[model samples]
Target chain A: MPHISLPDHLPGITGLLEFSQNTAAPIRELTQILLRGDNSLTQGERELIATVVSHNNECRFCTSAHTAAADLLLGESETCEMVKYDLDNAPVSDKMKALLTIAKMVQKSGKSVSPEAITNAKAQGATDIEIHDTVLIAALFCLYNRYVDGLASVTPDDSSFYQYLGERIVNHGYTRLPQGYDHLKNS
Target chain B: MAYIKLPDNAAGMRGLMAFRPHLAPHLGAFTEGILCIEDGLTKAEREIIGTLVSKLNDCQLCEGVHGAVAACYLDDNEVLIEQIKEDYKKAPISDKLKALLNIATSVQKGGKYVSESQIQRARDLGATDIEIHDTVIIAATFCFFNRYLDGLGIDPIQDSEIFRQRGRMIAKGLGYAPKK
Candidate 1:
């Protein structure tokens, strides 16, 4: 399925990361900043964008993982769908929707995100940092989607994988998998 | 015409970077665990993933910055990089990396956008979980960074060589133990 061999059958850059050490630190740093670093957007909001983009990209492993994580931060079902389907129309605060709108534009085209988008986001009380982080989040997801789809990595067979992983990731944070994660080799 | 005031930008990106020198201090150390693998992927590969993702997103700033960064490990073939930006599948890359780019694409769009069959396809091709995990994070994070550049209205530098030089320094670590 993947274009190449992988460590746990997941595709894309993850497989490549396994056998090498020189590149890990930078990659890890980048990932941490993307998911965990403090920014204008909350972790849930950030992960929610990932879920939306993952869904758009049809990257299941990522979708399930982030969706489950979104559930933890937002809630199950309704809020999750809100994050997945309609951030602009979701029940989130106006500032959030404005930020999400700007984020979507970042996904669509950096140029398409008009001045109004930034203005509206700012009027809704989005800070320069918030606006900046929103665009960053969206732009980063585009790169991520390409990476996974480009490599054609394998996703976990279980839908619950993300849910379980989300809990662990949310509690412990990204980069650190649950204990005995290496046992996934047995899966 | 600009979303943010013009005078503020040059100072903003610099000021922000100056303040948050630890862009990913914790994440860098935490994610190193999966650095182990059989296929021999390196940090450069992940950076390429981010760079390619940024390119696809069309953020001239990020594309220029990360593109230059990605070029550090790769041979200095501008056409090849251009080909990758235009279309990775048609570009010159190993079968292994091509698959990773697919996964990264999924991550860029959003995790839910990735389908079950896609995962199966990658696995069928022999993708591993660590690779998958790292790809997800990379994709997810690039989205963050892509937005950061675009949202802040950071203009792409005309001289890409500067970003490339920065990438070289990054390849060797922050050096000063993160001033932040």
Candidate 2:
């Protein structure tokens, strides 16, 4: 069914890291900084950017997962749906809407983000850092959306799964797959 | 009136734990390591790659927040960020950054989008192998991060202050604390 079918459970990037201890530390460190760390964005905002982009790519697993996470963070069902599909309709601050618009532009066309969108977001107080971060998040998500979709990993169709993962991710971090969750054997 | 209502990621994180688990710490370190280079690309240029890619991907979460991250380093200069965000090629940045971003853009589209010529151009502009490698990695990793976040559909934190503080923190080297 998938374009490039991997095993039900593949070793993924984790195994590659383990192959070389020296390489692994630096890889892990970089991963953490990109995902978490301080930026002009919150963890939630970053997640939202991923969700929106994935939605465009139509990566079901990513869409569902991030939607669940979005619901968890903002606490609004209609809003989540709106943000998932048409964020313009979603009730958000003007600045945010403009920013979201710009993000979508980046996703759709890297070279198409309108100067007006930038101006609008900036007018609403979007900073250069915020703008840059937005573009970064959008660009990075494009890769993520492709990678997940490219590799036919098991995309669980369960909101509960996302909810569970979200809480832990927020509390702990994306350090390792959950305990007792081994994919190498299955792969 | 940004829609701020939903069940949130807390409820869905459990399912994610089973499949992907928690790897943020590692990813965090990964990003930092890739970004720690002294003089290849200015912090602004590096963040530009990150911001531009995220923008292309259409990840609202990444866009909303990272836009702020890009802004922080730019001294809230939305215009400059916009120039890059709108059109990196025409943006008021050095040719080197523009070329590197072109390479990064290729990665965002698919490595095939990156050709030997682009790499050569970057090298010609004085990009080190390490810098090139890190740039690719950054692009590649963000792709992962973007999908993971989208897979989860986490709500974006729409607070400017939060990201402003984040910019400061990130500019501060993300500090080193032993992992728990």
Model 2 misplacement above 4 A: A1-31, A177-180, A183-187, B1-180
Per-residue lDDT tens digits for candidate 1, residues B3-82, read: 55444444324434543446535333433332222244566566677778777666676676556656665665556667
- Model 2 over residues B71-108: C-alpha lDDT tens digits? 76778876887788899888888888887788777777
Clashes of each: 96, 124
Model 1 score (lDDT): 0.63
Strongest candidate by lDDT: 1
Model 1: residues with Cα > 4 Å off, grouped in runs: A9-26, A29-41, A178-180, B1-16, B24-59, B62-147, B158-180
lDDT of 2 by residue, A1-187 (tens): 2222233443333333332234346543443554577866666666677678778777676667666666666665566677777787777777777777777876765445666777788799877556655765675566555444433335666566667666655566656544534544643
For each candidate in turn, give its C-alpha RMSD to the true structure in angstroms.
Answer: 6.5, 13.2
TM-score of each: 0.64, 0.48
lDDT of each: 0.63, 0.59
Per-residue lDDT, model 2, residue B22, is 40
**TM-score per model for chain B alone?**
0.76, 0.77
